[model samples]
Target: MGTGKRRPLGDRYQLISPTGRDGPGIIWRAHDLRLRRDVAIKEIQPLFRADGADLDGARRRAMREARSAARLSHPAVVAVHDLLEEGGRLWIVMELLEALTLKETVAHLGHLPVHWTAWIGFQLLGGLRHAHGAGVLHRDINPGNILLTGDRVVLADFGIAALNGDPSASTTVPLHCAPAYVAPERLRGLTASPAADLWSFGASLYFAVEGRPPYPGSDSLAVLGEAVNRDPDPPVKAGPLRRVLEGLLRRDPSDRITADHAARLLSAILRMEGVAVDPPRLPAARLPPDSFAR
Candidate 1:
C-alpha cells in the first residue's frame, strides 16, 4: 500500500484517514480489526536524515517518549492503548476522541463563558497534578493540546513531555512546542520543569478567556521575547478568575501559584451560587515580588 492508501499495521490496526500531524509524527484515524473499534495512531518518522542525523536514534527516542506518556493514567489525560513497530516506523495507538480542541473552540466562539473556562482549568490542573505525581512534566500545555468532549476536558499531545529526573529526558530532540505558551525559564535555557507546565497552563487559560495568548505575537521568536521581558497583559474577561491567572503567570517559578492553590480557587468559582464573586485571596506568603530584575 502507498502512503495515501489504507494500510494494515501488524494484524490489527488498519489505517483509515489522516487525522493530523505533530512534529515528526503523522496521526491517523484507524480501525482495530481485532477489537472492532477506532483508534488514533501516531506514526513517528525520522525528520533529520537530510541533516545527517541518526534515524535509528530518532526512532528509539520517539518510542521512549510514547512509553513515558503511556505511564500516565487519568480521565483528563488521553489514553495510550498500545505501541507498535512495523514497516520501519513506530506507532502510538490511542483512544479516538470526538471533540474540538480548546483552540478551535476559542476561534469559533471567541472568549468562553467564565464558568466554563474555570471548569476547563480545574480539569486541566487535575490532569497536570496527576502527571507531576508520576514524574512526568507535560512541557507543552496550550489551547491546542486541550480538548473538549461533551462536558469533559482532556489534555493531549505528549510528544515533548519529559521525565522529571531522567537524564535522557533532557537530551531528546526537542519537538517544536508552541513558543507563545512556553515558560520564561525555558526561554532562558533552563530545563523543563513542573513550573514550566504551570506557566503554560496559565497561558492556556488566558487564551481561553481572552481569545488570544497572553503575549500576542505574529511568530514564535517575537512571543518568546515578550514572555521573557514582559508580564502578561491583564485579563479583562477573567472576572473572579483574574487572581488565579495573575498568580500562575508570575515570571519567577518560585513565585507562581502551586497547582493545589489554583485548584482551590477554581473550586470556589465553580461552587459559587449567585453572580460570580472574586475568589478569596490566595495566601500572601506564597506569592512574592518578581525575582527577575526589570
Candidate 2:
C-alpha cells in the first residue's frame, strides 16, 4: 500500500464496473463473479509493508469487524455478507446502502435543524443500544462513519470496533475521523469504555448542528490537541440542547451519558419539539455498485 493505488479495471467482474475502496481495503464495485449479484469488495494483502505489531493487529481486527458486524443484527449496523480470499487478496462484502455520510449530510444541510438533530440522535442511540447490549463497543464513532438516508440515520463503519470485555482489542488513530471522538483513556492505549462512545455520538451530532467540526483546526492532529486540552465552543444558539450536549461530550468518560440514557434524553427533546421520528435502519455504505459496499 506504499503506492496506495487501486487494481486495474477489467472484465473480471462479469463486465460490471468496480467502484473503489473506502478504508484500508482495495474496494471494487462489481457483479459477484460467483454469486452473480451486485456487491462491494474489500481486498487486503497480508504481506504489505506494515509495522510488525500493526500487521497482526489489523488482520485480527478485520476478522473481528466482519464477525462483530455480523453479530450486531440491527437495522442500523451494516451487515457483513461474506469474507473471502481470491489469490493473495482477502475481501469482505457488505450490504449496499443508498445514503450520504453524516459528513456529506452536514455539507448539504449547512447545519441540521435542532428538532431534526434530536430526531436523528434518537435513532443513532437506538442503534447504539442494540450494539452495546450485544457487547460490542464502537470505538470509532464519528460523522463520516455514520450513513444517512433522508431522515433515517444509520451507524456504519465498524472497522475499528472492539468487542466488550475483549482484552485483545485495540484502537487505531489514523482509522478514526477525529481523535476528538476517541476517549482520552483510549489515547493512552486503554480499553474503550461505553461512555466514550456517547461522547462521540454527542460530538457527531454537535458537528451536524455546528457546521464545522466540534474541534476544527488546520488538521486532525490540531483538532485532537484542542479537543483533549480544551472545551469545544458550544454550537451557535444551541438553546436547551446545550446542557445535554455538554453532558454527552464530557471529557471524563465516566461523566458522560451512555447510549441508553442518551436515547431517553434525545427522545424527550424530540417529544418537546413535536418532531416526527422514524426507526433507525442499518444504514449501508458501498464504494460503488459493481465492487464493494464497505
Candidate 3:
C-alpha cells in the first residue's frame, strides 16, 4: 500500500497508517468507516508456508487474545471491540486512545516521581484485580504494554493473556516474554497465576522509579537466568515503594503479595504523601517516540 492510498478492510475499516509491528502482525491506526471513529487494529498475517498445525495455532492464539480481553470491563483495561477474519488475516479491533506508553514516558523523563508511580501502580492493580476476578491471567505485563493517557493509567495488550481453566491456554507455547519483567516462577516454567502478573507489575514499578530494570542483562537468556536464580537488586529510589516492591518480587509464588494488598500499600503511599488520586496529566505530544504499537 502506498502512503497516499488508504487500504479498506471489508468496507468497515480503512487503514490510515501502520503504527508498528506486533509479533507476527502489524498494528494500525485505522478509521471505522461505519462508526466514523478512529480505532486501533491488530492485523495478524497468515503463515503461508507453515504446516497446518502452525497456521491453525496462530489463528487460535489470536482468538484466545480476543476472548481473554473481551471477558473483562474495567476503566484501566483496554476494550476489545471486535474480532474479524478478513482476507485470510486476523484483525482485532480495539478502542483507540491517544496516549504515551509507560516505556516512552520513562525514557523521556528518565524516571517518574514516587507518588506518580504509586498512582499508576494503584490503577494497574485495579485492572489486574478485575481480570483475575474473571479468571483471566495477564501472562505478560511490562512498561511497553502500559498506557498513560491523561490522569488515567491503562493496561493494554492482552495478546498473551491466559484464561484460567481454558484448556487451550495451557497448550500453546509462548514464543517470547519480557524477561526483565517476567516473574521468577514463570521463568522456572511453572503455571502462571495472578502472582505472576503481580511480580511483573513489581518489576515494572521498579523500572518506573529507578529508570532501569531491576534485573540487568544484555540478552533474554541472561535476564531470565538472573530472574530465576537470584533476587533483584534493592531499589535505591523506591523509598516509600520499597516494601511494596519487595513484597511483590518475592521469588516464591506463595510469598508474593496479593493484588488487593499491593493496591492497599500503593494507596497508602499516595495518601501519606498527600498526592491526589488523579495527578496532573501530561499531553502525549510532549512525550517522544509516539507509537501506539503495543
Best candidate per TM-score, number? 3
TM per prediction: 0.88, 0.81, 0.89
Give lDDT tens digits, candidate 3, residues 68-125. Answer: 8898888889999989887777899999888898989999999998998998998887
lDDT of 1 by residue, 188-274 (tens): 877777777899999999999999999997887787778889998999999988999999999999898888788888888888824
What is the overall TM-score of model 3 with all chains considered together?
A: 0.89
- Candidate 2 ranges with C-alpha deviation above 4 Å: 1-15, 18-20, 33-36, 45-58, 175-177, 277-294
Worst 10 residues of 3 by lDDT: 285-294
lDDT of 3 at 230: 95
